[model samples]
Target: MNVTTGLFYVFSAVLLFAAFRVITARNPVHAALYLVLTFFQAAMIWMLLKAEFLSITLVLVYVGAVMVLFLFVVMMMDINVENLRVGFWKHFPLAAIVGVVIALEMAAVLMGGFRVVDDPNAVAAAAEANNAKELGKLLFTQYLVQLEVAAAILLVAMIAAIALTLRARKDSKYVSPGDQVRVRSADRMTVVKMDATQAAVAPVAEVSEPKA
Candidate 1:
């Protein structure tokens, strides 16, 4: 009916289509791309809901970083499409049922239309307020220890990933930092000091020609 409602419907439609494609697409790369589209649509919806901080974070973290990583991983992976599709028809009914259930649940939730207007002025004031700053304050004050723990966990995970990547491989050559730091020119190379003398030529023996 209204412009906001129209935009919501449009974004919702595109989001649903993209989400469906993410599962149905044969190619993993295409699926990842579709998932990116889904994330973008969800971010748009968050923006419309006036959750600017969440919307921007969703776009930056998920669309920019996570989806890019997913695309890279999907593209790099050697997937056998035929093997993947082998059980598609066999599993289609169950997948369709689950999908239908999720759709119904979402439809039920969205039946309560958008625009919560308990107080328009309050909503406008809240919208004008700095949500990112408020969120940061809450994180630092209310859930500081939890936030720190999460950060520590993420750091550990990152370290574990790097450690796994640095594991020794028989086929791969890795330069050790200590070895590089301790390397000497003398150990790496030896300059030969040979004189540039002309090579000696042997005298040719002249054979006496026999009378033919």
Candidate 2:
């Protein structure tokens, strides 16, 4: 009906399309990029909804940092596309049904439940005044448990990534920085100062050759 409504629909369409492509896309890199697009669209929608703190945070953290790292890893990894697609046929029906059910549920929950308000924010600087401080307070107070859960999830992801990339090679050596930092040259090398005194006592031996 108005600009906000129009923008909402546009952002919604982009988010939906990108989310769909995230699962359906064959390339892992493409999937990551689609996911980035989805995050961006959601950020925009959130901004329109006056959730500037969350919107900016989503852009800065997820789209900027996390997704960039994901894209880098996906692009560098040796992912087998053909092998990945092998079970696509077998999984498609279940996946599609699950996707449709989720979509329907979300639609049912959102469609008639939303009420548009006439509040256009009392002050333009109100969001800026409260942005980071409010978010930090809320995150550290009300949503602390959620924040911890997210951290735990990220830690698990990091562990999974490490496990995926871990390899042992017979020819290669690995050392921890902490271990290296604690090591001393005396532990690794022998230093003999017996130098000059030992040198003076050593005499040249006469060489003897045997007939071949």
Candidate 3:
């Protein structure tokens, strides 16, 4: 009917399609690409809803950095696709049951929810101000500890990932950058003074050549 509603439905459809493809696609790289698409669609929807901070964060953090890294990691991994899909049919019933349970739980929770009245004036007011400022206030004032905890968890996870990936292989020829940086010219090159003495001396010519 309205432009916003039309855009919402279009974005929602694309988001759903991308999400489905992420789960159904056999190729891991394709799945990651679809997931990036999903994040982009979700970010657009959030932008439409006036959550600019969250929308930008979604696009920048998830689609830009995280998904790109995930795609690289997925591409690098030696995964066996045939073995991964070995029992899809066997797990169908169980998967369906879990899906149904989640749907029912969401339904039950939503059914108990109270709907807000449409405020035309509030919409105009919201348009005049940035939502991110309010969100920042709420985050810093009310949810600082929770946000800190989440950040701390993320930091720890990052450190753990780096630690897990790093290995000191004795067989591998690796150079320590710190050690390399500390090296002086003497460590890399040697100056032999005997080389100057060994340099060919111009043979003295006869008096005739000197006169010429």
Q: lDDT tens string, model 1, 66-183?
A: 9898888878888898788888878989989998999899988998776567998998888788878899999999999999999999999999999989767799978889999999
Residue-by-residue lDDT tens digits, candidate 3, 34-147: 998899899989988888899999998998898889888888889999898888879978987998899899999988885664998976786798688988999999999999
- The collision pairs in model 2 are none
lDDT of 3 at 36: 89
lDDT scores of the candidates, listed in order? 0.91, 0.88, 0.89
The TM-score, computed over Cα atoms with residue i paired to residue i, of candidate 3 is: 0.75
Runs with alpha carbons beyond 4 Å of true place in candidate 2: 110-133, 143-170, 173-212
Clashing pairs in 3: none
RMSD of 2: 7.9
lDDT minimum window of 10 residues, candidate 1 = 111-120
> TM-score, each model?
0.77, 0.62, 0.75
Which candidate gets the maximum lDDT versus the true structure?
Answer: 1
Ranking by TM-score: 1, 3, 2
